[model samples]
Target: MSLRLAPSSKPSTAGSASVFDTSNSYGLHDTMRFGMRQIASEVTAKHPLENRLAEWENTQDELKMNLARNMYGMHAPIKMAMERSLVIKARGPSMLPRSSNLGLDILVGKDETIDFEDFLNVPELSTDMVDVHTVMEHQLGIRV
Candidate 1:
């Protein structure tokens, strides 16, 4: 024969202490206030590159390193392989957009035809593409 233990008859207030106390007993408001004060003190006591600012500095350093690597052709082989893989993957059979003569006539005059070559030859189109390429290159440190 075995005996079973009885459950406690005390009131259930397990998670109530941390959630709804405006008196600052165990709520998040006090914790956030303390953390903000600590961060402010540290910022005031140290150089600009201390603590959280160090993280930003480290990120900038990493971006500079990646830029140097790309400039020196260290990532060229991997980049080329990835480009080739993407090209091969995209060349697989896929549905092409249906050609609607009415839509084409509306877009380009009935006497004129719009093709990829004609699109590329458009000055405004080329300028927009160049602007996008320039911005991306500036951000990524790699020419498109």
Candidate 2:
């Protein structure tokens, strides 16, 4: 396999790591060339199978989260035990509000005339609550 080596921009000292410098052993170039080739191949190639597997894993994770939320409240002692376990393991500082993690594009305006992009991009909070009915009107408005 062909490997290209760019000329060094800096002088090599006894402590420095430079391939072109003659201060180091000549055999170092072969080792560096092999390492560079391995890294190049890893960076450029994408395996489709890995992408598919990751997508499947993400879907399964969402299903598991939904299942936990649905079932935990339905039962009594099981939910209590789960809460206790979670409490014991939770040693980190308190998390930030959910609004901090939300994306800008997720917000919906109360009417079509309102600019949703400008509403969402506001740095400060506008209101505590939202009306879904006002945001989404009856489907009868459209003939189709």
- The number of clashing residue pairs in each candidate reads 0, 0
**How do the predictions measure up, each by TM-score?**
0.17, 0.19
* lDDT score, candidate 1: 0.42
Off by over 4 Å in 1: 1-52, 75-144
What is the TM-score of candidate 1? 0.17
What does candidate 2's lDDT look like per residue over 24-82, in tens digits?
36444455433332344335444655545545534443454455557665464355446
lDDT (CA) per prediction: 0.42, 0.40
Candidate 1: worst-modelled 10 consecutive residues by lDDT: 1-10
Write down the RMSD of all candidates, one decimal each. 23.7, 19.6
Best candidate according to TM-score: 2
After aligning candidate 2 to the native by TM-score, how far in Å is the CA of 74 from where it should be?
Answer: 11
Best-fitting candidate, scored by lDDT? 1
